[model samples]
Target: MDWNCKNYHTLDFELKKYFGEKAIKLSINGGFTCPNRDGSINTCGCIFCSEKGSGDFAGNVDNSINNQINEQIKFLSNKWKSNTYIAYFQSFTNTYDSVINLEKKYTQALNCPNIKGLAIATRPDCINENIAKLLSSYNDRTYLWVELGLQTIHKNSSDFIRRGYDLDVFNNAISMLKKYNIRVVVHLILGLPNESNHDILESVQYVCTKGIWGIKLHLLHVLKNTDLANYYYENNMKLYTQEEYINLVCDCIEIMPQDVVIHRLTGDGKRSELIAPEWSLHKLKVLSAIDIELRKRNSYQGLKFNQEQK
Candidate 1:
């Protein structure tokens, strides 16, 4: 795939490759909350978690699932001609509920007209055999993938972030999802606290080995009203510059297996809530710089990939 004449296999290209048209994702808030915030793990969510439970752009939780889908479709149809859409349950801990409730919440979205698939996002510890089985059954019916928040593979980093889970839990979750042949997408945050470049890439290498169908490489966004925001000022945290972040993303893209779809290369939050790396506010410029930088280096996805390396 030419991937929009870029250096990596983007989700947009992947969708076009399969559907022959654009597949816009409709972010849905299922009124779900994370265990990490529900006192199951702790009251506080991840250090960078937002008051919206990381669903800053998701549909309103006040509306019914069907209403949210319909509203998004109506809003997006005017802008995009394509009818295809993937209902992304992007809020905190989409699968934290019982298997019965998971089925109901998922079916509500999947039943919506023009909704082509489901992208359920959640933490690793929340998954089990029942959830995998349920998602696998859905996989047989539509295009689907589960996104797990494994921000970093390093335990120290994970611990520092109060991620509330271990690498072993993530490893087990992936194994379970793979056993059911469910498409899996893992989220990795670049420029985490105290992590060197090597630490970041090593985390990338580790997750790619899990047979991930897609990957979301999120640039760490420091948001207001989170522990990270306070820590940023208290500890004087330094974030990645535009140039440095683009370079790191290119490195991860090159090392990623060619088949793994790049779901996201950057992240966005409400500008008013964002505290640093003001350059990241220019999402379009940041994205274009990535393509230009890759072209400048004459590199492409999987160019530096060594799957055999430890």
Candidate 2:
């Protein structure tokens, strides 16, 4: 059987089609903060967030953006050997700062010799007309993707996770980004506490109706020293087993539209920080299982998609 997925679009294929070559993302921490953590909203931050603000796999925050990108390029050169790179601002609310500072950091990345584009991860509430305009100006110069963290659309799940914004906020952000022709990538988490399987699928369907570019599907990870960890210890929270997760992800992929690139299928938690769902450490195994299960079902992405849903 052909191992390449025929039913769905992968990030690698999309990148190759656009850049005409293999381009790897170099994670960069822009030393940004979030309203949820800075007293602008709340102080506890997301219940599942780590001390590093979801930049555990990203480069050192203390280093300058340019330095971080350079260091990662040097390290990844030995592994991927691809000259093309995307400067991914992965930590915290990348757009929380003023427009002037945002331009400075983003411009610095664009000026890098090897960088081909920029991917900024931020919250929906943090965006506005001024910021959207500033980001749109780069559309002609280089590729730009605005990543929004929307763990789940369920109101209860959103509240449990301490996500400060509402679904309307996310919809408005998407509308603003689309107005500027900037690509949007949404982040969704499966197996959130108290959310049913139906809830997760509904979230996926909702995203498909919106005019977005890509989606990153992640498994809820319980990390050490976080409120989630404490809750797990106190309430005996249960996470999905490996087999259960594979089945759910395959189902999610089937319903996803073929044009929406699947940016990621699973979570990548640092071993040192991970507290539950130990099987997530074996990332390759999880990916292979998804592939195998899809083959078994003779299903590909969009197998269950309905145009009317959009």
Candidate 3:
């Protein structure tokens, strides 16, 4: 059962190392929106984003953090019976709001029962000194992780995707977060329209050199009601199939630093919102297929990679 590579760190095992037990990330919609999509930058968002701003499957915002935690606890406990949970503020730029608002939402989740820590996903440009200071303070009491969406290092690709930020923002955020000892997780989307496979792999290598603690891989997805959908309809977009994606994912993993946690290897497509590359709707099947192929090949993360070899 060595999937893709022997040196790779699976996300489950990585969590156990920090939590001392099984830990679940309770995905919460903290009622946040990205500045890029909020008319500040005058962009609709990344072309692949859905109308709900990628939080469509996130927990209902009508409930308070405590209520959301309590509800999820019941469902997860009865189903998986896990005792530890991490309040994951997923969807949109979680740190884009003011410090007071950030404190209110995060404190509510932190006070919830069974929650052992917090994880906030946001854009690199949205991170501020106040956000970093507030988040770093929690390290003394609980695990704190900030997940940044650094989709690519290439400026041309970033501009084409309208990510609304630059690589310098990511570098600065990572540096400041590390100075305070807060764990950093980077989200790198593979298969942007014009990037070659080598371009994607180069980004992974760059992130590793930046001292990231974890990484998540997502195959480029074209969802309904997105600018990407327009491109698809116009025959201007290219997407990766399950087989193509799995191979590239394995290759990326093989080149990743041995200790960087692999948070995800596939994207969970929102069925109602997805438009093209329909195979993504079957995420489990794709992941399992990746695992099977990796084992058969006796390959592992970092197996074919060496920085000097690059």
TM-scores, all candidates, are 0.98, 0.98, 0.94
Sort all candidates by lDDT, best to worst.
1, 2, 3
Model 2 Cα lDDT, one tens digit per residue, 95-182: 9999999999999999998899999999999999999999999877898898999989999999999999999999999999999999
- Candidate 2 is scored at a TM of 0.98
lDDT of 3 by residue, 79-120 (tens): 775778999998788998999999899989999888888999
Superposition error at 165 for model 3 (Å): 1.2
- Candidate 1 residue runs with Cα over 4 Å from true position: 307-310
Q: Rate the local accuracy (lDDT) of all candidates.
A: 0.92, 0.91, 0.84
Candidate 1: tens digits of C-alpha lDDT, residues 168-273: 9999999999999988999999989899999999999999888999999888989989999999999999899898999999989889989899998897868988
Q: Which stretches of candidate 2 lie over 4 Å from their true place?
A: 1-6
Whole-model alpha-carbon lDDT for candidate 3 = 0.84
Give each prediction's root-mean-square deviation over alpha carbons.
1.1, 1.5, 2.2
The CA lDDT at 109 in model 2 is 91
Q: Considering lDDT, which of the candidate structures 2 and 3 is the better prediction for this target?
A: 2
